[model samples]
Target chain A: MIEVENLTKTYGSYNALKGINFRVEKGEILGFLGPNGAGKTTTMRILTCFFPATSGKATVAGYDVFENSLEVKKRIGYLPENVPLYKDMEITDYLTFVGRIKGVSAKDIKTKVSKVMGDCGITHMAGKLIGELSKGYRQRVGLAQALINDPEVLILDEPTIGLDPKQIIEIRQLIKNLAGRHTVILSTHILPEVSMTCQRVVIINEGRVIAVDTPHNLTNQIQKAARIFFKIEGPAVNVVKELNKVKGVKMIEKKETSNGVTDYIVELEKGNENRKVLPELIIKNGWGLHEMRSVEMSLEDIFIKLVTEEKGVKT
Target chain B: MRNFYLIFKKELKSYFYSPIAYAVMTIFLIITGYFFYNIFATFSTLSFQAQMNPTLAKQYNLLNISESVVRPLFGNVSVIMLLLMPLLTMRLFSEEKRSGTIELLLTYPVRDIEVVLGKFAACLAIFSIMLVFTLLYPFLIKIYGQPELGPIITGYIGLFFMGAAFIAFGIFASTLTENQVVAAVLSFGVLLFFWMAGYSISFVSSSLVSVLSYIALTQHLESFAKGVIDSGDIIYYLNFTMLCIFLSLRALESKKWRG
Candidate 1:
């Protein structure tokens, strides 16, 4: 569990974290979604006790990060941005070293190292030097280092960055598996990564937290109106007039017309079953219905809209 | 203590894993060995001259092998250490900071002092090994002639402490920057300034002369090299080493304050 209350970090004239607040429940995987220079790494660094916050408090597992940093550090595993690692060390050796510093018992270090290597899918590269590995493997090695101690809390900054698409999927799966066992707070600029892996998301921008909610709720809260994409082979002018006459049909914008088919995006009022009404309306009009699908706003759209300050709802 | 040991082991292992340690040790040995040979050659020539002439023997006082050869050998080794210890310690913290490994290292449960001491111990260990290799010079001298054991032992103690102080300063320098070359050059300059500080005593006011001499790193080594183990000199080197280590610890802790 982690609690950050009004945590502010300032560097000279610039503020990296402007009194941001968030809480992550035990075994909950919280995604810290923000664009570049948005204080994600700075927040993670303060939580990891790499540095103390300029103001306010952050507690991990009931220990204050500033007052009881050693205890917090003992219970938390951090994978810093850039995945810093001793490049000359072998994979197993590096993991074992981290395990030792993380306070794993000497007798259990071997098992822990092997287990994490397996968990991160770097088992075959155990004997290879970290410097010799490719970027993806190096990223895995960094993850393995963080998991070596099996700490109660895991703080990962941009964990999937620089990995190939396949590696990224594998890592996301690995992190998703960690839910309900280890409390995870991973930061990323990638929007869908939050929707796919995190139970809740915290969207931050310009040193301030803009919104925090479940990925699904964020989309629903930001949409305001339902949008449906429809293709119909009908007279465009007459179809628009008839659709406007239907109750709860707010607007219909003609997207494009080609090959005698017109693509229309219909904005329907909330709680309206315009989807059920549209097909009958087209049939009565003697028009062939080509395609009809509701268009849900993806997390990507919500992210951009929130970050760009078009719409936001704090939870 | 356990944290210190773990960090120390990792640091020492890293040194051996990289080429810099081997390169520094070999270069240190080769250069020191050359100096040792030259000093010994000059001593041998002087002794041979003394043997051929009684007046020269009385004038040169060639019977004190410790003074003529062992003491100067230690002096040369100390100078060699002054040059090489920077190379050994430049990467201790600078490379970690440069490669961004310091982030993970600092976040570990280990205390800040433990990291500084652990790194200090590792560099001291490597310097000790280099010192051990130089024992061959004394061993050869012992085989060919009789050297006083007192000065040999005392000189080593002096070299050990002096080299350790050099390493501690180098570690502090390493902490000040993320650039290895900058760390190395900065430490070398600081050490050379202190080593040359004693020479400026005559140029300073009488009241400031003692201060300059006391702070000069080389002045403390002479007492040990001369077979006189003054507690004052011992305390000076110990305090110097501790001050540098403390400075390094503070530099490391500054991250929490300023970051």
Candidate 2:
């Protein structure tokens, strides 16, 4: 539903977006993951036709963002960062105004506005002025305004930035529910929001797309050595020495505890099954293994490693 | 057209709901009303002989009000408009740009011209309402005395065009800055220069005076105040208004491309 090719935006001396290239298939929820000032908002604004790119081409729903901006604009719904709203207007009134601007029929505006209000769960506050709403409610109202025209593509920038935990979960669930119907391209610094709501993730940093893959694949790609953690009720020195003696154990780190319990983290080379061998080795050594678990790498770890590591993949 | 109407309606509704519109209207009425009542009382104290024999009137009527008092008072109406119209229009695009709502507006299916025209129409409508309220001054003069209805009508026509020109200039100024105060002050300064330039023309030679007078908006308004519907003066005001609006549109487009 969206195609961007060598998209670059420069503001005087600074390049906000550096030749970004990506595509989103119809009905795919693509999460734009990046740290702050990672060109996420710039890319979103370019795609939505709010601004033109300095160099490069982008099209949405088969319409060029520059040449056919009106068509692209009609097809995409954008919720900008901070959810700019007229504070003096009521929630319903604001939605109606947005609907009218989006070219919704007068008769249909009422139904569509109410439907979006229900979808975002802000129906109860329809009569409340936007200034009087809580941050969570205001974000929901912004979402409702974006969704009122039932756009084909939804471009949301930090949709849940200021919301509380429960509100975040609610918004994540709401975005997830939009998966198959709306082609969503959301940019956020929150990694879990992407993992929960998006099927594919595009990791951008310093104005470049660093990695694009499924969250699981991203995690697996970064995870080289399989590590396992153990809390054993035994002598710490003996446990570390025996773990090092295990055939496939490449590295081990032991922790000293006053309770006579030893904690060790053991790393085994890839393609090695540490779980199947760990119990037999513990039995042979007469060491009591109180608890054992594989320490799998999470998306957070991969994200931090990818963003922090300087000389890695250029793509 | 439909999009323009929609934007226009929303903008107009915003004016009614916001305190700026009401505050400007109230302040405009109070100040203009005071000046109007004071001028009328002063006019009432004078007799027709005061105009024929100024030397005799200088003895009895210590305050010598001129036949020019009516025109200058009406001209002061333009000054009042210059101050208030900027306040009315300062939020036209500046507020939207500052709040990031301009992004939402631009991403809509509407063309850029629609947004500009919609905002222009809304500001003009509010200005028309304020002008309508000022009509009470003309009507009071008509009821209390037999003031020439022709010049009064033409004077109002001059005020209308002057207000339109100021509104367009104000909108253009508002487009330049996000802060309403800066927008208002800039527009006021621009309008004041044009207003005072007409009077300052006397200090220069007649040849250069005509050039400066042409640049002065009030000089064009003088023909309208004389009950003469000169197409040249009308076109001048229309062209000035259009130039400001065109500049405003260009500024908005530049913002989208450069900012």
Candidate 3:
């Protein structure tokens, strides 16, 4: 539904998007995960035809964003960051305005507005002014407006930034429900948001696409070395040194110490089966073996690892 | 045109939703009403004297109610519009830019011209409503005295076009900044410069004086105020309005690249 190739945007020597490339298929929820200033918003702006890329091409819904912007725009709905809204307008009024401008027919505008309001769970706030709504409700109104046209492609920049925990879960579930119907490209700095709501994740940093894969696959790809957390009742330095002497042990780092039981993360070499040896070694050394468990790599870990790894490679 | 009307309706509704429109209208009506009363008082006193002394009436041109009262009323209203138009148009684009609503607006399927014209038409509509309220002046003149139809009609035409030109320039100024006050001040400065453009004619050479006079906003309204409907003045105001609207469109278009 969206294709961006060599899309570069520069603001007078400051490159906002440095020739990034990505493609989103129809009816797939693609989570654009990135840190601040990662060019995610810039890329989405280009795709939505908010602004042209400094160089290269972008097409949305099979129409070039530059050459056929109107056609592209008609098929795409955009919710910008901060959820810009007409604060003075009523909820229904704002949604109707968006629907009309998005080319929803007059006869259908009322139904479409009501449908989106129901979809976004903002039906009860129909007659209230937008300025009177809370932050979460305002965000819902923003989402409601984006869905007013029933657009084929939805570009949302951080759809759940300021919401509380429950609202975040609600929004995530709402977005998850949108899968297989509208092609969504939502950007967020929140790591777990991608794992929870997106089918595939594209991690970008510093105007570059560093990794793109399913959340499960990303964790697997970056989990080359098995990590085990060993809590032993002994001196931390001696336990780490003794663990380092074992075969296939890549590294061991002390985590924390409390009541003479120390927590340590031991990295094993790929294909190493020394999971049994570590506990035995602790038992044989006269130190008490408190607990032994393998730590599964999460999307957050992979995200930090990959971002730091990219910075390490650059330096 | 459909998209333009959609935007126009929304913009016009938003104007009434905010207090700026009411405040500007009230202020405009109050100031213009004061000027009208002052002009009417002078006209009434002059006519009372003219009834007593016919020679003085001829010398003062008090014989024509339209000349003594209606013409000055239109002129005063035009000046007042110059001051209030900036307030009316300052937030047209500036508010959207500041609030970041311009992003969603531009991303919609509407063309650039549609957005520009929609906003321009909204401000023009508000200015027209304000002008309509001032029509009470002409109606009052017709009630108490005989007022010439030509100057009253032509004077209104002049105010309409002149106010439109002012609005276009105001929109252009609004697009240049996200700050509403800055937009208002910038447009007010531009309008004031053009309002006083003809004043420097006497200091310059005769050849340059005619060019300055042609460019002056006040000079074009002179023909209409005198009940003279010259195509040249109408065309000048139209051309000025078109140029400012075109410039506003270009400025809005440049925002895409400049972003």
Candidate 4:
């Protein structure tokens, strides 16, 4: 539903997006993960035709964002990071106005708005002024507005930034339910949000795509060759040698023994699940293995690792 | 056209929902009302004295409605329009930008001209509403004396063109910044420049004086207020207002790149 190629955007001397490429297939929920100032909003703005890219091409809903911006806009729903809304308007009125501009037919606006309002859990605040609504309700209203015309693609920037934990879960659940129905591309720094709702994650940093894979596959990759910290009761000098001899071991760093139990942090090559052989190896070397536990690398740590690497970003 | 229509409707509603429209309207009516009463008082006194002293009325053209009331009233009213038009148009694009709704508005399938024209039409609609209140003066004058239909109609036509020209410039000013006050001040400065352009003719060379008088916003209306509907005045006002609107479209288009 969306394709971006060499999308470069520069504001004067500072480059916001540096020739990055990514795509979101039809009915796929792609999580765009990046730290602040990672050009996430810049990318979304280009797709929505809010602004033009300096050099490159982008298409949404099979229409070129630059050449056929109107057609692309008609098929895509955009919820900006700030959720730009008219403060004085009532929720229903605001949604109606959005519907009108979104090109929703008059005969369908009432039914479509009411349905989206219900889906976003904002039906109760239909009569309330948007300015009077709390932040969470305002977010839901923003989501409802983006759901106008049953858009084929929904681009949400930081959709749940200000929501409380419970509201976050509710929004995540709603987004999760939309996976098969709409192609969603949401950019957020929250890792768990991607794990919770996004089917495929594209991690961007410094205006480049550093990682792209399924969350499950990423976690599997992290688990398969995770570093293991070992506290063994043995002489420190020989322990490093024996540990490095293990067929799958990539590197081993040893520290002085505390209470005579030598510590070793080992990073094994990827797909090395031969942790079962570690205890046997220590026994064969006459070393008493006091502790043998693999260090758990969470999704956040993986993201930080990929982003900090200067080149050879995993994708 | 449909895009323009929707945006125009929303903007029109926005004017009524906010206090700015009412505030400008009330002040406009009060200012116009003061002048209306002043003109009516002068008209009544002049005619009353004319009835009493026929020789005095014959000696002076003071008893004529076109000179005593019609000319001065529109001349002053156009000044009021120039001053107040910024208030109506300053928020047209600036508020949308300040509130960050400009992104939403521009990203919609609507074209740039639609947004510009929609806002221009909305401001024109609001100014027209305020201008309508001044019509009561003409109606009242008709009740007492025989107000010449030609000059009365042409005076209003002049006010419309002047108000429209000011509105176009005001909308252009609004597009230049997100600060409503800055927009208003910028509009005030531009309109004031045109208002004084004709006055600068005496100080400048003769070659430039003709150009200055031609560009002066109030100068073209002089023919209309005098009951002379010259094609020059029509073309000047039409082209000037259209140029301002065109400039506004260009400004809006540039935002897509500059942003």
How far in Å is the alpha carbon of A141 misplaced in model 1? 1.4
> Candidate 1, residues A1-315: lDDT per residue as tens digits?
899999999998899999999999999999998878989999999999999999999999999999999999999888988988999998887888889988999999989888888889988877899999998898899888888888899999999999999999999999999999999999987768888999999988888899999987887789878999989998899999999999999889999899889999999988885678889999999998999999877656776777656344432
Q: For candidate 2, write residues A1-315 as lDDT tens digits.
A: 899999999988898888899999999999998878889999999999988999999999999999999889999889999899998888888999999888899989899998999889888887888999998898999898888888999999999989999889888998888888999999887666777888999998788898999877777788878889888877777777777877778889886565777778888988875668777878777777788888877656776788767455443
- Candidate 4, which CAPRI tier? medium
Using lDDT, rank the candidates from best to worst.
1, 3, 4, 2
Rate residue A99 of model 3 by lDDT.
Answer: 94
Which candidate has the top score in DockQ?
3
For model 4, the chain A TM-score is 0.78
Identify the runs in model 2 with alpha carbons over 4 angstroms from their true place: A227-243, A247-268, A276-300, A307-315, B48-70, B205-207
lDDT of 1 at A167: 92
Question: What DockQ results for candidate 1?
Answer: 0.71
Which residue pairs in candidate 1 have backbone atoms (N, alpha carbon, C) closer than 3 angstroms, thus clashing? none
How close to the true structure is residue B67 of candidate 2, measured as C-alpha lDDT?
Answer: 35
True-vs-predicted CA distance for residue A261, candidate 2, Å = 7.4
Q: Candidate 4, residue B178: CA error in Å?
A: 1.2
Query: Clashing residue pairs in candidate 4, if any?
Result: none
Better of 3 and 4 by lDDT: 3
lDDT of 3 by residue, B1-259 (tens): 9999999999999999999899999999999999999999988888788889868866746667877888888889988888889999999999999999899889989998999999999999999999999989899889999888988889899899999899999999999999999999999998999999999998999999989999999999988999889999889989988998899899988978884
State the DockQ, from 0 to 1, for candidate 3: 0.74
Which structure among the candidates has the greatest TM-score?
A: 3
